[model samples]
Target chain A: MTSSNETVSREIQLAARPQGAPKDSDFTLVERQLGQPGEGEVLVRNLFLTVDPYMRGRMNDVKSYTPPFALNETMTGGAVGEVITSNADGLKAGDLVLHDAGWRTHALIPAKTARKVDLLPSISPSAYLGILGMPGLTAYAGLLEVAAFKEGDVVFVSGAAGAVGSVVGQIARLKGAGRVIGSAGSADKVAHLTEKLGFDTAFNYKDGPVSTLLKEAAPDGIDVYFDNVGGDHLEAALFAFNPFGRAALCGAISQYNATEPASAPRNLALAIGKQLTLKGFIVSSYSHLSAQFAKEVGGWIASGELHYDETVVEGIENMPGAFMGLLDGKNTGKMVVKL
Target chain B: MTSSNETVSREIQLAARPQGAPKDSDFTLVERQLGQPGEGEVLVRNLFLTVDPYMRGRMNDVKSYTPPFALNETMTGGAVGEVITSNADGLKAGDLVLHDAGWRTHALIPAKTARKVDLLPSISPSAYLGILGMPGLTAYAGLLEVAAFKEGDVVFVSGAAGAVGSVVGQIARLKGAGRVIGSAGSADKVAHLTEKLGFDTAFNYKDGPVSTLLKEAAPDGIDVYFDNVGGDHLEAALFAFNPFGRAALCGAISQYNATEPASAPRNLALAIGKQLTLKGFIVSSYSHLSAQFAKEVGGWIASGELHYDETVVEGIENMPGAFMGLLDGKNTGKMVVKL
Candidate 1:
């Protein structure tokens, strides 16, 4: 969908709070008249948007790292856009930018808030929303830094076909992990991990219990586990952890939408005997590492040492459905909505 | 209970493995002929024997930090004794010593495994089995090193009336912790914690729910948690943990005798958002710090800053009952049997 030429901006607003799994009706399409940018402000036409699992946390009225999304207001998230007009000295019209003005086709943003981006010959602007953006930084810092990855350590990753998990497995291998294993929801994604992403081995968690599959994949046990899907995945990872093992707890997509609390790991006692360390974190916690992250991971992508995939949904109207679908595992890799 | 000139040594042996809570039938009273000390060995007439919760873990025929106790065997643990006979260099008859010769009135032990005690008249020989022995070392290393205690950090301890937990709270306070709170199983134990052990506040976990009690105890949040009791206590600590909080997971006494595996903290997700670190450790992991630990904690005791208690049971025949009582929370601090 193109930005309205009639001076009105189309945006997605939270019509109601979700009870469990979010439905399309929970969001509504609305329009607002575009106003001229004031000093240090710019008007942007949003092009590519990110719909991530963490957005689910922001939907709740509970205390968290970020504030909750207020009902009847335009939902905001990460987006890449073109500056239609600028009142700030550093930026101008036609400049491509990245900003937290998602769920809308056009946004009146402070020019200081929108970061100017250079269109690389080899990299797409939308790639900044996935591989070169928050997701990539999360995978990078959560593994090498937060989990304190050691060279030649065996690594296990859950939700391994998705944006962060896929990058974590590849990064582990590239950084000298002895063996890298990934668990995905389907045989195709599992095949893609090993065959396409260069993971050492991959398995479909749907085939059997995660514990049995993990035991078979890494019979000797894993030194590090990057957890994206919590619940049984976290429990199974605890079972397969070696002595002095570390687990980087990044997300719990499995229990994110649950109306009731999820069941906890029954064998957590194993952690005590194993001298295990489990650390939970958000990527934003290590935002200072982004400069180095972009430099390192950017080189990998440029030299084709890393490969990435994107699942695209069309139009701002499709954002809510894509996000819900992402939660349901209907999409692979980074699920993005292109307007 | 006197050393029988009759040449027979009274002992408590594992009669069978326990199923749930250890039963009386699981243990048996036995007798052995007292043998003369061989070369490189010493004959120890046991004075004080320690019965710890960890012994319950040894009863199960599963791999753990230490080997499982074989059926009908005299269980080995920390004890203080008098050297009745010595056939090794540097050790003499009638010398006081400490050795892992618990559950028996007389023990034939390798001299290399027995360390001679200076017999500090200021401190009882039994105090070595509690305050200056394995339990004390466990609390020292677990709190200061493993938990990475920083001055002014708010500290919370679970199983706060037991041998290890009691020392942990005192150490946190003596080291300049901002506030110290403890959770125990009974009103008497809670009273003893706040009234005698110098804890800032103490609560009976049996009096109310742990989460509610914890929220009331530390309204702001806790910076460090020394976990001796696991299960719900761990879950509650996770809830009350501040950003970058650390937990030294010392023991899961609450789950040691559990027939079924215990549920882990369902809200373990809080660890992710708060950048929490949970590290499980056995004291032996830090045994290298024992010399330093003894010097420091011993100094605390010398200054009267450290106080210790032992609930003594007389005779080797009562060893099994004292051990079961330790697990049942019948004792206030260290539970030891005197021969």
Candidate 2:
């Protein structure tokens, strides 16, 4: 029998390389003993975990900006947890922290790897995984820096109901974009983007071809495109972009889980005539902007200038399901697994 | 009977729109009577006319940076002519002038529109069509200004034996590019690029695949790509670009005559990860740089540092064939019709 003071942690490991959309068999839930925090490590009891589109790229065994997840090892991502035991300086028990040890109930993380979070009653800890976290910074830097957003620009964003794109649309509006348009997979998500997120117009991509929908919604043509879902959305943006248009290619969620390589955008030749610019980026590449992003967006949240939504799962065992659901367009905004 | 003092002009008019490549029937050489020069106009006897790739875009009934060539009207392009009768104070007869009145043996042009060329004993007037004219400014602006070429950059130029690409390669080298690679259609053009143009390496694209050939030529990858031919060559540039690589998209000659819409570059997605920048430009957009370009490149020409080639097609009636030959890549550098 286990002693009352002896803690056992449950974790999920990558069981197999996913061929397409990840199935339940791709992840395995394993229970292990918390060996004890040593040296600069801390024993973290995870409170919340993040399930994101970018994680899909890590599942494939290919070299990219980041390395693929090692098969049969514990998968990693963004998470919020409490320190149960600390062997490192500047960290103590009962301290809430943000870390990158995902899909786990507890973690023994290096103190330097975990950042202390000052808990607030108004803001949820999981916000660090969504609007106030990596996703938020991605929206900020991608729109302003990568795409070179100008005031009064008509901006269009794909995956507008998701964590990053939702913030992208909102920030564009707040930053004085003349009009903001968005595309989502479902009608409810479309409604949320236009009604709640203040997008000038929103379309359910499943209703019709994106090229037709984009042309109808943004008749004057878009100046900036924040591309999250690639494939047809990218092609549509190419068709709808005006001269000197810019695209911040933050993600290609639509093609991430695809088994076969995606098709080329047939209309990209228009870019030559229009003088368009497209720049791709991962959020981690702009970590230095975190403090500035947090200060500005955090103010937006606190002042009711910005609103965000969350779909939370209750257990760590459901983490894989939440991730798969995100890829399937099941989440309206941020997807969080509350352990 | 016509008076011996009068000049009868032979002009090539766009008789019909071609379904694919322009045919002989698409052009009609008609004789026109000329009247005395008006208050601000000059009577010009055309000497040499330029046939270029961009003219193909103007042949179609589409709105672009420049106006389309009207059916049954005389075609317009770069030309060097003698001012036959000048009624304006600034100009005089016997002066060689440059104007946009191509495909004609003589022209009645506005005096303000015709820029008198200061005769240089060292440089041919046709050099204004190939190197000292719009094509020259296109290469300079596309390479240095548009692509933001930097010293030590490994540059790759497509259509390298052509007027624009040959100049692009030479300019990049003179600007201190680490390596200058070029691609052409024939082995003779390839040898011309490497041997005459001083390209670090040159390849005949017909030898094999552009992707394989480009990788073999620039194993270290390219920092700047001057895209004159867009197709497999553009796709190859995307594949061969290093991080932060820049491409000055000058023209898409390869896709200009395509019956159907051109297909997109398949690996354009790689741009996101590599942080590549591709910018398209038309020469007219940078017309302000002409005097500055002329001052610099004209010196290069006068000093014999810049060597240029021309395929001269004699007679105004052969203008159509010369343009067709340019589309066919029969010309090594600039294709000009001497009327």
Which candidate ranks first by DockQ, i.e. highest? 1
**True lDDT of residue A78, candidate 2:** 92
lDDT of 2 at A336: 96
Could you give me the TM-score of model 1 versus the true structure? 0.97
Residue lDDT tens for model 1, B63-82: 87789999988888988999
TM-scores, one per candidate? 0.97, 0.96
What does candidate 2's lDDT look like per residue over B226-247, in tens digits?
Answer: 9988878988999899988998
Q: Write the per-residue lDDT of candidate 2 for residues A228-312, one digit (tens) a residue.
A: 9888899999889988899998888888777665675766667667888877777777888888898899889988999999999
Residue A239 Cα positional deviation in candidate 1, in Å, after optimal superposition: 1.0
For candidate 1, what is the DockQ-based docking class?
Answer: medium
Q: What's chain A's TM-score in each predicted model?
A: 0.97, 0.98
Docking class of 2: medium
